[model samples]
Target: MRAITLSEYGGPDDLEPAEFPEPKVAPGEVLVRVRAAGVNPVDWKIAEGLLDALLEVRFPLVPGWDVAGVVEQVGLDVEEFSVGDEVMGYIRKDTVQLGAYAERVAASVRLLARRPAALSWEQAAGLPLAGLTAYQSLERVGVAAGETVLVHAAAGGVGSLGVQLAVARGARVIGTASERNHGFLRELGAEPVAYGDGLAERVRELAPEGVDAALDFVGGGVVDLSQELLRRRDRVASIADPEAVAKGGHYVWVRPDSVDLTVLADLADAGRLDVPVDRVLPLADAAEAWRYSRTGRARGKVVLTVD
Candidate 1:
Protein backbone atom coordinates (compact mmCIF):
# COMPACT_ATOMS: atom_id res chain seq x y z
CA MET A 1 0.00 0.00 0.00
CA ARG A 2 1.17 3.51 -0.78
CA ALA A 3 0.65 6.09 1.96
CA ILE A 4 1.69 9.52 3.12
CA THR A 5 3.85 9.02 6.19
CA LEU A 6 5.10 11.40 8.82
CA SER A 7 8.42 10.39 10.41
CA GLU A 8 7.96 12.86 13.28
CA TYR A 9 5.70 15.64 14.47
CA GLY A 10 5.99 18.39 11.91
CA GLY A 11 4.03 20.35 9.29
CA PRO A 12 3.20 19.60 5.64
CA ASP A 13 6.89 19.46 4.72
CA ASP A 14 7.23 16.41 6.94
CA LEU A 15 4.70 14.36 4.96
CA GLU A 16 6.34 11.87 2.58
CA PRO A 17 4.96 9.38 0.09
CA ALA A 18 6.18 5.85 0.72
CA GLU A 19 5.33 2.20 0.24
CA PHE A 20 3.72 0.94 3.45
CA PRO A 21 2.54 -2.43 4.65
CA GLU A 22 -1.13 -3.35 4.24
CA PRO A 23 -3.32 -2.55 7.22
CA LYS A 24 -4.49 -5.45 9.34
CA VAL A 25 -8.22 -6.18 9.41
CA ALA A 26 -9.18 -6.84 12.99
CA PRO A 27 -12.36 -8.63 14.01
CA GLY A 28 -15.43 -6.38 13.55
CA GLU A 29 -13.48 -4.38 10.97
CA VAL A 30 -13.32 -4.24 7.17
CA LEU A 31 -10.50 -3.48 4.76
CA VAL A 32 -11.41 -0.58 2.45
CA ARG A 33 -9.74 0.26 -0.83
CA VAL A 34 -9.46 4.02 -0.54
CA ARG A 35 -10.98 5.99 -3.40
CA ALA A 36 -10.80 9.43 -1.81
CA ALA A 37 -9.71 10.96 1.50
CA GLY A 38 -11.00 14.18 2.96
CA VAL A 39 -8.28 16.64 4.00
CA ASN A 40 -9.18 18.31 7.29
CA PRO A 41 -7.41 20.79 9.55
CA VAL A 42 -7.21 18.09 12.22
CA ASP A 43 -5.00 15.98 9.92
CA TRP A 44 -2.37 18.73 9.80
CA LYS A 45 -2.94 19.59 13.45
CA ILE A 46 -2.20 15.98 14.38
CA ALA A 47 0.82 16.08 12.12
CA GLU A 48 2.06 19.16 14.03
CA GLY A 49 1.64 17.34 17.37
CA LEU A 50 -1.21 19.65 18.45
CA LEU A 51 -3.14 16.70 19.90
CA ASP A 52 -0.13 15.13 21.68
CA ALA A 53 -1.66 15.19 25.14
CA LEU A 54 -5.04 13.83 24.07
CA LEU A 55 -4.37 11.11 21.48
CA GLU A 56 -1.90 8.21 21.38
CA VAL A 57 -0.09 8.78 18.07
CA ARG A 58 2.61 6.59 16.59
CA PHE A 59 5.51 7.26 14.26
CA PRO A 60 5.14 6.95 10.46
CA LEU A 61 1.53 8.02 11.00
CA VAL A 62 -0.92 8.18 8.12
CA PRO A 63 -2.97 11.31 8.83
CA GLY A 64 -6.57 11.19 7.63
CA TRP A 65 -9.92 10.11 9.10
CA ASP A 66 -12.54 10.80 6.43
CA VAL A 67 -12.79 8.18 3.70
CA ALA A 68 -15.05 7.18 0.81
CA GLY A 69 -14.07 3.79 -0.51
CA VAL A 70 -15.07 0.26 -1.39
CA VAL A 71 -14.96 -2.66 0.98
CA GLU A 72 -12.36 -5.11 -0.28
CA GLN A 73 -12.50 -7.66 2.53
CA VAL A 74 -14.58 -8.21 5.62
CA GLY A 75 -13.18 -9.31 8.95
CA LEU A 76 -14.66 -11.86 11.34
CA ASP A 77 -18.19 -11.21 12.68
CA VAL A 78 -18.79 -8.36 10.21
CA GLU A 79 -22.28 -8.63 8.70
CA GLU A 80 -23.26 -5.02 7.95
CA PHE A 81 -21.24 -4.88 4.69
CA SER A 82 -19.40 -7.19 2.32
CA VAL A 83 -16.91 -7.01 -0.52
CA GLY A 84 -17.72 -4.38 -3.21
CA ASP A 85 -19.91 -2.31 -0.89
CA GLU A 86 -19.47 1.41 -1.33
CA VAL A 87 -19.00 3.14 2.02
CA MET A 88 -18.01 6.38 3.68
CA GLY A 89 -16.84 6.77 7.24
CA TYR A 90 -15.04 8.85 9.80
CA ILE A 91 -12.55 6.11 10.66
CA ARG A 92 -10.84 7.52 13.75
CA LYS A 93 -9.53 4.77 15.95
CA ASP A 94 -8.57 4.86 19.63
CA THR A 95 -4.98 4.94 18.42
CA VAL A 96 -3.93 7.31 15.60
CA GLN A 97 -2.10 5.53 12.77
CA LEU A 98 -2.76 3.70 9.48
CA GLY A 99 -5.48 6.13 8.41
CA ALA A 100 -7.43 6.89 5.21
CA TYR A 101 -4.52 8.77 3.58
CA ALA A 102 -3.24 5.41 2.44
CA GLU A 103 -4.31 3.27 -0.49
CA ARG A 104 -6.21 1.12 1.99
CA VAL A 105 -7.41 1.23 5.63
CA ALA A 106 -9.14 -1.00 8.16
CA ALA A 107 -12.26 0.58 9.65
CA SER A 108 -14.56 -0.78 12.32
CA VAL A 109 -18.16 -1.65 11.45
CA ARG A 110 -19.15 0.90 14.06
CA LEU A 111 -17.74 3.67 11.85
CA LEU A 112 -18.96 2.58 8.43
CA ALA A 113 -22.09 3.66 6.54
CA ARG A 114 -23.33 3.11 3.00
CA ARG A 115 -22.31 6.00 0.79
CA PRO A 116 -25.08 8.27 -0.52
CA ALA A 117 -25.59 7.69 -4.23
CA ALA A 118 -26.04 11.40 -4.83
CA LEU A 119 -22.53 12.30 -3.73
CA SER A 120 -19.37 11.68 -5.69
CA TRP A 121 -16.47 9.82 -4.05
CA GLU A 122 -14.81 13.13 -3.16
CA GLN A 123 -18.03 14.50 -1.68
CA ALA A 124 -18.60 11.30 0.25
CA ALA A 125 -15.05 11.40 1.54
CA GLY A 126 -15.63 15.00 2.64
CA LEU A 127 -18.97 14.38 4.41
CA PRO A 128 -18.22 12.12 7.36
CA LEU A 129 -16.20 14.23 9.79
CA ALA A 130 -17.55 17.66 8.97
CA GLY A 131 -21.12 16.49 8.56
CA LEU A 132 -21.03 14.52 11.78
CA THR A 133 -19.59 17.48 13.63
CA ALA A 134 -22.36 19.74 12.40
CA TYR A 135 -25.09 17.15 12.98
CA GLN A 136 -23.88 16.27 16.47
CA SER A 137 -23.55 19.91 17.37
CA LEU A 138 -27.13 20.58 16.22
CA GLU A 139 -28.28 17.56 18.17
CA ARG A 140 -26.46 18.79 21.27
CA VAL A 141 -28.10 22.18 20.97
CA GLY A 142 -31.52 20.56 20.39
CA VAL A 143 -32.35 22.59 17.33
CA ALA A 144 -35.99 22.24 16.28
CA ALA A 145 -38.27 23.36 13.50
CA GLY A 146 -39.35 27.02 13.31
CA GLU A 147 -36.48 27.98 15.62
CA THR A 148 -33.83 30.46 14.57
CA VAL A 149 -30.29 29.07 14.85
CA LEU A 150 -27.04 30.93 14.37
CA VAL A 151 -24.04 29.13 12.86
CA HIS A 152 -20.57 30.63 12.98
CA ALA A 153 -18.16 30.33 10.02
CA ALA A 154 -21.05 29.26 7.82
CA ALA A 155 -19.06 29.03 4.59
CA GLY A 156 -16.29 26.76 5.81
CA GLY A 157 -16.44 22.97 5.54
CA VAL A 158 -18.29 22.16 8.75
CA GLY A 159 -20.27 25.37 8.88
CA SER A 160 -21.61 24.96 5.36
CA LEU A 161 -22.87 21.53 6.28
CA GLY A 162 -24.17 22.89 9.59
CA VAL A 163 -26.25 25.48 7.79
CA GLN A 164 -27.78 22.88 5.49
CA LEU A 165 -28.50 20.44 8.32
CA ALA A 166 -30.11 23.10 10.45
CA VAL A 167 -32.19 24.19 7.50
CA ALA A 168 -33.19 20.61 6.82
CA ARG A 169 -34.44 20.41 10.38
CA GLY A 170 -36.82 23.28 9.41
CA ALA A 171 -34.96 25.86 11.47
CA ARG A 172 -34.36 29.36 10.23
CA VAL A 173 -30.57 29.57 9.94
CA ILE A 174 -28.42 32.64 10.41
CA GLY A 175 -24.83 32.01 9.32
CA THR A 176 -21.68 34.09 9.81
CA ALA A 177 -19.12 34.45 7.03
CA SER A 178 -17.23 37.04 4.99
CA GLU A 179 -19.05 39.23 2.49
CA ARG A 180 -17.69 37.12 -0.33
CA ASN A 181 -19.46 34.02 0.96
CA HIS A 182 -22.74 35.60 2.04
CA GLY A 183 -24.29 34.56 -1.25
CA PHE A 184 -23.00 31.04 -0.75
CA LEU A 185 -24.59 30.89 2.67
CA ARG A 186 -27.86 32.11 1.21
CA GLU A 187 -27.72 29.21 -1.21
CA LEU A 188 -27.43 26.85 1.77
CA GLY A 189 -30.69 28.35 3.14
CA ALA A 190 -29.08 30.57 5.73
CA GLU A 191 -29.54 34.26 6.24
CA PRO A 192 -25.93 35.38 5.85
CA VAL A 193 -24.31 37.75 8.32
CA ALA A 194 -20.76 39.09 8.11
CA TYR A 195 -18.55 38.05 11.00
CA GLY A 196 -16.63 40.39 13.39
CA ASP A 197 -17.36 43.99 14.38
CA GLY A 198 -20.92 44.05 15.64
CA LEU A 199 -21.73 40.53 14.53
CA ALA A 200 -24.18 40.15 17.38
CA GLU A 201 -26.00 43.27 16.25
CA ARG A 202 -26.21 41.93 12.73
CA VAL A 203 -27.79 38.72 13.97
CA ARG A 204 -30.10 40.75 16.21
CA GLU A 205 -31.08 42.75 13.18
CA LEU A 206 -32.39 39.56 11.62
CA ALA A 207 -34.05 38.24 14.74
CA PRO A 208 -35.01 41.12 16.93
CA GLU A 209 -36.18 38.93 19.81
CA GLY A 210 -32.98 36.76 19.72
CA VAL A 211 -32.05 33.34 18.37
CA ASP A 212 -33.25 30.02 19.79
CA ALA A 213 -29.96 28.16 19.37
CA ALA A 214 -26.40 28.76 18.16
CA LEU A 215 -23.57 26.61 16.81
CA ASP A 216 -20.03 27.93 16.96
CA PHE A 217 -18.03 26.08 14.33
CA VAL A 218 -15.11 28.55 14.26
CA GLY A 219 -14.60 29.07 17.95
CA GLY A 220 -13.16 32.12 19.62
CA GLY A 221 -15.40 34.47 21.57
CA VAL A 222 -18.38 33.38 19.48
CA VAL A 223 -19.78 31.35 22.34
CA ASP A 224 -20.19 34.54 24.35
CA LEU A 225 -21.62 36.26 21.32
CA SER A 226 -24.01 33.39 20.85
CA GLN A 227 -25.18 33.62 24.44
CA GLU A 228 -25.93 37.30 24.05
CA LEU A 229 -28.33 36.47 21.21
CA LEU A 230 -29.56 33.09 22.36
CA ARG A 231 -32.89 33.02 24.22
CA ARG A 232 -31.30 30.48 26.56
CA ARG A 233 -27.64 30.81 27.42
CA ASP A 234 -27.15 27.05 27.33
CA ARG A 235 -28.57 26.64 23.84
CA VAL A 236 -25.17 26.94 22.20
CA ALA A 237 -22.55 24.42 21.13
CA SER A 238 -18.93 25.00 20.19
CA ILE A 239 -16.62 22.61 18.40
CA ALA A 240 -13.56 24.90 18.41
CA ASP A 241 -13.83 26.35 21.92
CA PRO A 242 -13.22 24.07 24.91
CA GLU A 243 -14.39 26.75 27.32
CA ALA A 244 -17.95 26.39 26.06
CA VAL A 245 -18.63 23.95 28.87
CA ALA A 246 -17.37 26.45 31.45
CA LYS A 247 -19.55 29.12 29.89
CA GLY A 248 -22.68 27.00 30.33
CA GLY A 249 -22.71 25.99 26.64
CA HIS A 250 -21.82 22.67 25.03
CA TYR A 251 -18.35 21.98 23.62
CA VAL A 252 -18.69 19.18 21.11
CA TRP A 253 -15.92 16.82 20.05
CA VAL A 254 -17.25 14.89 17.06
CA ARG A 255 -17.52 11.13 17.47
CA PRO A 256 -17.85 8.46 14.76
CA ASP A 257 -21.27 6.79 14.78
CA SER A 258 -22.69 4.69 11.98
CA VAL A 259 -26.23 5.81 12.79
CA ASP A 260 -25.38 9.51 12.61
CA LEU A 261 -23.38 9.03 9.42
CA THR A 262 -26.35 7.22 7.90
CA VAL A 263 -28.68 10.09 8.72
CA LEU A 264 -26.34 12.40 6.82
CA ALA A 265 -26.22 9.99 3.94
CA ASP A 266 -30.00 9.91 3.86
CA LEU A 267 -30.12 13.69 3.72
CA ALA A 268 -27.68 13.66 0.82
CA ASP A 269 -29.72 11.02 -0.99
CA ALA A 270 -32.88 13.05 -0.41
CA GLY A 271 -31.24 16.06 -2.05
CA ARG A 272 -31.35 18.14 1.12
CA LEU A 273 -27.60 18.09 1.80
CA ASP A 274 -24.67 18.73 -0.49
CA VAL A 275 -20.97 18.47 0.36
CA PRO A 276 -19.26 21.36 -1.40
CA VAL A 277 -15.74 20.37 -2.39
CA ASP A 278 -13.27 23.22 -2.68
CA ARG A 279 -10.35 21.32 -4.15
CA VAL A 280 -9.37 17.78 -5.16
CA LEU A 281 -5.68 16.83 -5.33
CA PRO A 282 -4.00 13.54 -6.00
CA LEU A 283 -3.06 11.37 -2.99
CA ALA A 284 0.65 12.07 -3.45
CA ASP A 285 -0.08 15.80 -3.05
CA ALA A 286 -1.36 15.42 0.49
CA ALA A 287 1.15 18.03 1.59
CA GLU A 288 -0.27 20.55 -0.84
CA ALA A 289 -3.80 19.84 0.38
CA TRP A 290 -2.71 20.57 3.96
CA ARG A 291 -1.20 23.90 2.88
CA TYR A 292 -4.43 24.83 1.10
CA SER A 293 -6.50 23.86 4.16
CA ARG A 294 -4.28 26.02 6.38
CA THR A 295 -5.02 29.01 4.17
CA GLY A 296 -8.59 29.15 5.61
CA ARG A 297 -9.90 30.21 2.24
CA ALA A 298 -11.70 27.08 1.10
CA ARG A 299 -15.45 27.55 0.68
CA GLY A 300 -16.07 23.94 1.56
CA LYS A 301 -14.23 20.61 1.89
CA VAL A 302 -10.84 19.68 0.41
CA VAL A 303 -10.24 16.12 -0.79
CA LEU A 304 -7.35 13.91 -2.01
CA THR A 305 -8.16 11.41 -4.75
CA VAL A 306 -6.41 8.07 -4.91
CA ASP A 307 -5.35 6.73 -8.31
Candidate 2:
Protein backbone atom coordinates (compact mmCIF):
# COMPACT_ATOMS: atom_id res chain seq x y z
CA MET A 1 0.00 0.00 0.00
CA ARG A 2 1.12 3.54 -0.72
CA ALA A 3 0.47 6.08 2.04
CA ILE A 4 1.34 9.57 3.17
CA THR A 5 3.20 9.31 6.45
CA LEU A 6 4.66 11.56 9.14
CA SER A 7 7.89 10.54 10.82
CA GLU A 8 7.18 12.84 13.75
CA TYR A 9 4.82 15.59 14.81
CA GLY A 10 5.16 18.40 12.28
CA GLY A 11 3.44 20.35 9.50
CA PRO A 12 2.63 19.61 5.86
CA ASP A 13 6.32 19.58 5.05
CA ASP A 14 6.63 16.54 7.28
CA LEU A 15 4.24 14.45 5.20
CA GLU A 16 6.01 11.98 2.92
CA PRO A 17 4.74 9.49 0.35
CA ALA A 18 6.02 6.01 1.00
CA GLU A 19 5.24 2.35 0.55
CA PHE A 20 3.73 0.51 3.51
CA PRO A 21 2.41 -2.98 4.18
CA GLU A 22 -1.32 -3.59 3.85
CA PRO A 23 -3.13 -3.56 7.19
CA LYS A 24 -4.40 -6.83 8.59
CA VAL A 25 -8.19 -7.05 8.94
CA ALA A 26 -9.35 -7.48 12.52
CA PRO A 27 -12.51 -9.22 13.63
CA GLY A 28 -15.62 -7.03 13.15
CA GLU A 29 -13.69 -4.92 10.58
CA VAL A 30 -13.52 -4.69 6.79
CA LEU A 31 -10.74 -3.66 4.43
CA VAL A 32 -11.68 -0.80 2.13
CA ARG A 33 -9.92 -0.10 -1.14
CA VAL A 34 -9.65 3.63 -0.92
CA ARG A 35 -11.22 5.74 -3.66
CA ALA A 36 -11.06 9.09 -1.88
CA ALA A 37 -10.13 10.62 1.45
CA GLY A 38 -11.52 13.82 2.93
CA VAL A 39 -9.13 16.51 4.07
CA ASN A 40 -10.03 17.96 7.48
CA PRO A 41 -8.36 20.43 9.84
CA VAL A 42 -8.06 17.75 12.51
CA ASP A 43 -5.90 15.66 10.14
CA TRP A 44 -3.31 18.41 10.07
CA LYS A 45 -3.90 19.30 13.72
CA ILE A 46 -3.08 15.74 14.63
CA ALA A 47 0.00 15.93 12.43
CA GLU A 48 1.13 19.02 14.34
CA GLY A 49 0.75 17.23 17.67
CA LEU A 50 -2.21 19.40 18.70
CA LEU A 51 -3.99 16.30 20.05
CA ASP A 52 -0.90 14.87 21.73
CA ALA A 53 -2.34 14.68 25.23
CA LEU A 54 -5.62 13.20 24.04
CA LEU A 55 -4.68 10.54 21.42
CA GLU A 56 -1.99 7.92 21.29
CA VAL A 57 -0.08 8.55 18.05
CA ARG A 58 2.69 6.28 16.75
CA PHE A 59 5.57 7.03 14.45
CA PRO A 60 5.20 6.85 10.64
CA LEU A 61 1.56 7.86 11.11
CA VAL A 62 -1.05 7.98 8.38
CA PRO A 63 -3.35 10.95 9.09
CA GLY A 64 -6.83 10.76 7.69
CA TRP A 65 -10.18 9.56 9.12
CA ASP A 66 -12.77 10.21 6.40
CA VAL A 67 -13.00 7.65 3.59
CA ALA A 68 -15.21 6.59 0.68
CA GLY A 69 -14.33 3.32 -0.94
CA VAL A 70 -15.20 -0.30 -1.79
CA VAL A 71 -14.98 -3.16 0.60
CA GLU A 72 -12.31 -5.59 -0.55
CA GLN A 73 -12.43 -8.09 2.31
CA VAL A 74 -14.58 -8.75 5.35
CA GLY A 75 -13.28 -9.85 8.69
CA LEU A 76 -14.71 -12.47 11.02
CA ASP A 77 -18.30 -11.99 12.29
CA VAL A 78 -18.97 -9.13 9.83
CA GLU A 79 -22.40 -9.50 8.20
CA GLU A 80 -23.43 -5.91 7.42
CA PHE A 81 -21.27 -5.70 4.26
CA SER A 82 -19.29 -7.95 1.96
CA VAL A 83 -16.75 -7.68 -0.83
CA GLY A 84 -17.55 -5.06 -3.52
CA ASP A 85 -19.86 -3.06 -1.27
CA GLU A 86 -19.48 0.71 -1.65
CA VAL A 87 -19.09 2.41 1.70
CA MET A 88 -18.13 5.62 3.44
CA GLY A 89 -17.03 6.00 7.04
CA TYR A 90 -15.32 8.05 9.71
CA ILE A 91 -12.62 5.45 10.42
CA ARG A 92 -11.04 6.95 13.52
CA LYS A 93 -9.66 4.20 15.72
CA ASP A 94 -8.46 4.33 19.32
CA THR A 95 -4.93 4.54 17.87
CA VAL A 96 -3.68 7.09 15.31
CA GLN A 97 -1.95 5.10 12.59
CA LEU A 98 -2.85 3.31 9.31
CA GLY A 99 -5.63 5.65 8.23
CA ALA A 100 -7.61 6.36 5.06
CA TYR A 101 -4.83 8.35 3.36
CA ALA A 102 -3.67 5.10 1.82
CA GLU A 103 -4.48 2.59 -0.87
CA ARG A 104 -6.57 0.65 1.67
CA VAL A 105 -7.61 0.78 5.31
CA ALA A 106 -9.30 -1.63 7.72
CA ALA A 107 -12.23 -0.10 9.59
CA SER A 108 -14.74 -1.50 12.04
CA VAL A 109 -18.28 -2.17 10.70
CA ARG A 110 -19.42 0.09 13.55
CA LEU A 111 -17.94 3.00 11.61
CA LEU A 112 -18.99 2.05 8.09
CA ALA A 113 -22.19 2.80 6.16
CA ARG A 114 -23.36 2.17 2.61
CA ARG A 115 -22.43 5.16 0.44
CA PRO A 116 -25.26 7.31 -0.85
CA ALA A 117 -25.77 6.70 -4.58
CA ALA A 118 -26.37 10.43 -5.17
CA LEU A 119 -22.89 11.39 -4.02
CA SER A 120 -19.67 10.88 -5.94
CA TRP A 121 -16.79 9.16 -4.20
CA GLU A 122 -15.26 12.54 -3.45
CA GLN A 123 -18.49 13.90 -1.98
CA ALA A 124 -19.06 10.72 -0.03
CA ALA A 125 -15.57 10.96 1.42
CA GLY A 126 -16.30 14.52 2.53
CA LEU A 127 -19.53 13.66 4.32
CA PRO A 128 -18.73 11.28 7.17
CA LEU A 129 -16.77 13.51 9.55
CA ALA A 130 -18.35 16.90 8.85
CA GLY A 131 -21.85 15.56 8.32
CA LEU A 132 -21.72 13.48 11.48
CA THR A 133 -20.45 16.47 13.45
CA ALA A 134 -23.26 18.69 12.22
CA TYR A 135 -25.90 15.99 12.62
CA GLN A 136 -24.77 15.03 16.12
CA SER A 137 -24.57 18.67 17.16
CA LEU A 138 -28.07 19.40 15.89
CA GLU A 139 -29.28 16.24 17.59
CA ARG A 140 -27.65 17.25 20.88
CA VAL A 141 -29.50 20.58 20.76
CA GLY A 142 -32.78 18.89 19.78
CA VAL A 143 -33.55 20.99 16.71
CA ALA A 144 -37.14 20.55 15.53
CA ALA A 145 -39.35 21.64 12.66
CA GLY A 146 -40.57 25.26 12.48
CA GLU A 147 -37.83 26.32 14.90
CA THR A 148 -35.24 28.91 13.98
CA VAL A 149 -31.70 27.63 14.40
CA LEU A 150 -28.48 29.62 14.06
CA VAL A 151 -25.36 27.92 12.68
CA HIS A 152 -21.94 29.51 13.00
CA ALA A 153 -19.36 29.08 10.16
CA ALA A 154 -22.17 28.17 7.82
CA ALA A 155 -20.06 28.08 4.66
CA GLY A 156 -17.38 25.82 6.01
CA GLY A 157 -17.44 22.03 5.73
CA VAL A 158 -19.41 21.08 8.84
CA GLY A 159 -21.45 24.28 8.96
CA SER A 160 -22.66 23.93 5.37
CA LEU A 161 -24.00 20.46 6.15
CA GLY A 162 -25.46 21.77 9.38
CA VAL A 163 -27.46 24.34 7.45
CA GLN A 164 -28.81 21.78 4.98
CA LEU A 165 -29.66 19.19 7.66
CA ALA A 166 -31.44 21.79 9.78
CA VAL A 167 -33.36 22.91 6.72
CA ALA A 168 -34.27 19.29 5.94
CA ARG A 169 -35.71 19.02 9.44
CA GLY A 170 -37.96 21.99 8.47
CA ALA A 171 -36.10 24.34 10.77
CA ARG A 172 -35.48 27.89 9.63
CA VAL A 173 -31.72 28.24 9.50
CA ILE A 174 -29.66 31.38 10.11
CA GLY A 175 -26.00 30.89 9.19
CA THR A 176 -22.93 33.06 9.88
CA ALA A 177 -20.24 33.57 7.25
CA SER A 178 -18.38 36.28 5.39
CA GLU A 179 -20.17 38.46 2.82
CA ARG A 180 -18.56 36.46 0.02
CA ASN A 181 -20.16 33.26 1.32
CA HIS A 182 -23.61 34.67 2.14
CA GLY A 183 -24.97 33.64 -1.25
CA PHE A 184 -23.57 30.17 -0.75
CA LEU A 185 -25.32 29.92 2.61
CA ARG A 186 -28.56 31.03 1.00
CA GLU A 187 -28.24 28.14 -1.47
CA LEU A 188 -28.02 25.80 1.50
CA GLY A 189 -31.37 27.18 2.73
CA ALA A 190 -29.96 29.45 5.43
CA GLU A 191 -30.54 33.13 5.95
CA PRO A 192 -26.94 34.30 5.89
CA VAL A 193 -25.44 36.68 8.44
CA ALA A 194 -21.94 38.17 8.20
CA TYR A 195 -19.80 37.19 11.13
CA GLY A 196 -17.21 39.10 13.32
CA ASP A 197 -19.09 42.29 14.29
CA GLY A 198 -22.51 42.56 15.82
CA LEU A 199 -23.17 38.95 14.90
CA ALA A 200 -25.77 38.57 17.62
CA GLU A 201 -27.50 41.73 16.51
CA ARG A 202 -27.64 40.53 12.94
CA VAL A 203 -29.17 37.22 14.00
CA ARG A 204 -31.64 39.12 16.13
CA GLU A 205 -32.55 41.21 13.12
CA LEU A 206 -33.69 38.04 11.39
CA ALA A 207 -35.48 36.53 14.40
CA PRO A 208 -36.68 39.35 16.60
CA GLU A 209 -37.97 37.08 19.31
CA GLY A 210 -34.82 34.88 19.59
CA VAL A 211 -33.69 31.64 17.95
CA ASP A 212 -34.90 28.27 19.25
CA ALA A 213 -31.51 26.59 18.91
CA ALA A 214 -27.94 27.45 17.91
CA LEU A 215 -24.97 25.48 16.63
CA ASP A 216 -21.49 26.98 16.99
CA PHE A 217 -19.02 25.50 14.52
CA VAL A 218 -16.52 28.36 14.38
CA GLY A 219 -15.79 28.56 18.15
CA GLY A 220 -14.26 32.01 18.82
CA GLY A 221 -16.65 32.87 21.64
CA VAL A 222 -19.67 32.21 19.42
CA VAL A 223 -21.22 30.07 22.15
CA ASP A 224 -21.79 33.23 24.21
CA LEU A 225 -23.30 34.92 21.19
CA SER A 226 -25.52 31.90 20.60
CA GLN A 227 -26.62 31.88 24.24
CA GLU A 228 -27.66 35.52 23.96
CA LEU A 229 -29.95 34.80 20.99
CA LEU A 230 -31.19 31.37 22.03
CA ARG A 231 -34.66 31.37 23.69
CA ARG A 232 -33.24 28.82 26.13
CA ARG A 233 -29.59 29.27 27.11
CA ASP A 234 -29.06 25.52 27.03
CA ARG A 235 -30.35 25.13 23.48
CA VAL A 236 -26.92 25.64 21.98
CA ALA A 237 -24.19 23.16 21.03
CA SER A 238 -20.56 23.91 20.21
CA ILE A 239 -18.06 21.60 18.50
CA ALA A 240 -15.19 24.07 18.70
CA ASP A 241 -15.69 25.44 22.19
CA PRO A 242 -15.32 23.23 25.23
CA GLU A 243 -16.38 26.16 27.42
CA ALA A 244 -19.89 25.70 26.05
CA VAL A 245 -20.55 23.14 28.80
CA ALA A 246 -19.52 25.64 31.47
CA LYS A 247 -21.76 28.27 29.88
CA GLY A 248 -24.82 26.02 30.21
CA GLY A 249 -24.64 24.99 26.55
CA HIS A 250 -23.46 21.61 25.14
CA TYR A 251 -20.01 20.88 23.73
CA VAL A 252 -20.16 18.05 21.19
CA TRP A 253 -17.43 15.62 20.25
CA VAL A 254 -18.42 13.75 17.10
CA ARG A 255 -18.55 10.00 17.46
CA PRO A 256 -18.63 7.40 14.69
CA ASP A 257 -22.00 5.64 14.54
CA SER A 258 -23.23 3.52 11.63
CA VAL A 259 -26.84 4.50 12.36
CA ASP A 260 -26.11 8.24 12.27
CA LEU A 261 -24.02 7.88 9.12
CA THR A 262 -26.83 5.94 7.49
CA VAL A 263 -29.31 8.69 8.30
CA LEU A 264 -27.06 11.17 6.53
CA ALA A 265 -26.76 8.79 3.60
CA ASP A 266 -30.54 8.49 3.45
CA LEU A 267 -30.92 12.26 3.51
CA ALA A 268 -28.53 12.52 0.59
CA ASP A 269 -30.25 9.75 -1.33
CA ALA A 270 -33.57 11.53 -0.82
CA GLY A 271 -32.08 14.74 -2.28
CA ARG A 272 -32.51 16.51 1.05
CA LEU A 273 -28.77 16.85 1.69
CA ASP A 274 -25.75 17.66 -0.48
CA VAL A 275 -22.01 17.52 0.12
CA PRO A 276 -20.24 20.64 -1.03
CA VAL A 277 -16.73 19.87 -2.23
CA ASP A 278 -14.31 22.76 -2.54
CA ARG A 279 -11.26 20.97 -3.96
CA VAL A 280 -10.09 17.51 -5.03
CA LEU A 281 -6.41 16.66 -5.16
CA PRO A 282 -4.63 13.42 -5.95
CA LEU A 283 -3.61 11.18 -3.07
CA ALA A 284 0.03 12.04 -3.71
CA ASP A 285 -0.85 15.69 -3.19
CA ALA A 286 -2.07 15.25 0.38
CA ALA A 287 0.37 17.92 1.57
CA GLU A 288 -1.08 20.48 -0.85
CA ALA A 289 -4.60 19.66 0.31
CA TRP A 290 -3.56 20.32 3.89
CA ARG A 291 -2.10 23.68 2.86
CA TYR A 292 -5.38 24.72 1.28
CA SER A 293 -7.32 23.55 4.33
CA ARG A 294 -5.03 25.63 6.58
CA THR A 295 -5.82 28.80 4.59
CA GLY A 296 -9.46 28.58 5.76
CA ARG A 297 -10.67 29.80 2.37
CA ALA A 298 -12.25 26.61 1.05
CA ARG A 299 -16.02 27.03 0.71
CA GLY A 300 -16.70 23.41 1.56
CA LYS A 301 -14.92 20.08 1.85
CA VAL A 302 -11.48 19.31 0.41
CA VAL A 303 -10.79 15.78 -0.80
CA LEU A 304 -7.85 13.64 -1.96
CA THR A 305 -8.56 11.18 -4.75
CA VAL A 306 -6.81 7.87 -5.04
CA ASP A 307 -6.31 6.26 -8.42
The parts of candidate 2 lying over 4 Å away from their true place are: none
Candidate 1, residue 106: lDDT: 96
Tens digits of per-residue lDDT for model 2 on 57-131?
A: 998899899999999999999999999999999999999998999999999999999999999999999999999
**Candidate 1 RMSD to the real structure:** 0.6
Compute each candidate's TM-score over C-alphas. 0.99, 0.99
The true-structure Cα RMSD of candidate 2 reads 0.6
TM-score of 1: 0.99
Question: Model 1: which ten-residue window has the lowest total lDDT?
Answer: 216-225
Cα displacement (Å) at residue 40, model 1: 0.8
Error of model 1, residue 269, in angstroms = 0.5
Residue range with the least summed lDDT across 10 consecutive positions in model 2:
196-205
